[model samples]
Target: MHEFSIAQALVEQIEAAATKEHAKRVVRVVITVGALSGVDPEALRSLFPLVAEDTVTADAELVVEPVSARVRCRACGREEAAETSFLRCSVCGSRDVELIAGRELHIKTVELEIDER
Candidate 1:
């Protein structure tokens, strides 16, 4: 599954950030995943723990926030939830709609612990 690759990337990012901030360990990683992002949340979570082995993020909790699919109709100026493939506006039933959200996959925040000397 591609979740392995995504998990690897997440670990790399977390390691870099933790090193830059001089963190002793990572506590949590908050990520935002859109409904249309095509990522399997269960699979992603399963891969994260494995990929984070022995890293600063090994003990970190992965928090995944799901974003809803939104679209705006060009003709009716209406905005509503959208389907994955069609992305049609529900209010106006128009196909000439622009996607407003639900296509994102990014790490929002990384909570880390600092060594207390």
Candidate 2:
């Protein structure tokens, strides 16, 4: 599954960050996943530990924040939540809508453990 690869990439990024900060270990990784991002949260969670087996994030907790799809209507200038299967505006019922959110796939925060000398 592509989630495995995504998990691997995530672990790599965490490792890089941890190295840069000279962290002893990664405590948590918070990521935002959009509804339209085509990523399965459960799959990613299941594969994360496998990908992080030998990395600094081996024991890191993966926290996923799900973002709902939102769109702005071009006809009525109304903004509202939308379903992935439907791109129409809720208020104006216009098909001409611009996606405002719910396509994100990025790390929001990284909690790390550092050794103090």
lDDT of 2 by residue, 51-86 (tens): 899788999999999999999999999999999898
Q: Which candidate is the best by lDDT?
A: 2
Error of 1 at 59 (Å): 0.8
TM-score of each: 0.93, 0.96
Each model's lDDT comes to 0.91, 0.93
After superposition, which runs of candidate 1 have C-alpha atoms over 4 Å from their true positions? none
Model 2 spans with C-alpha error above 4 angstroms: none
lDDT of 1 by residue, 1-117 (tens): 888888999899999999999999999999999998889988999989999998889889999999889998999999888777778877768899989999889999999998876
Cα deviation at 47, candidate 2, in Å, is 0.2
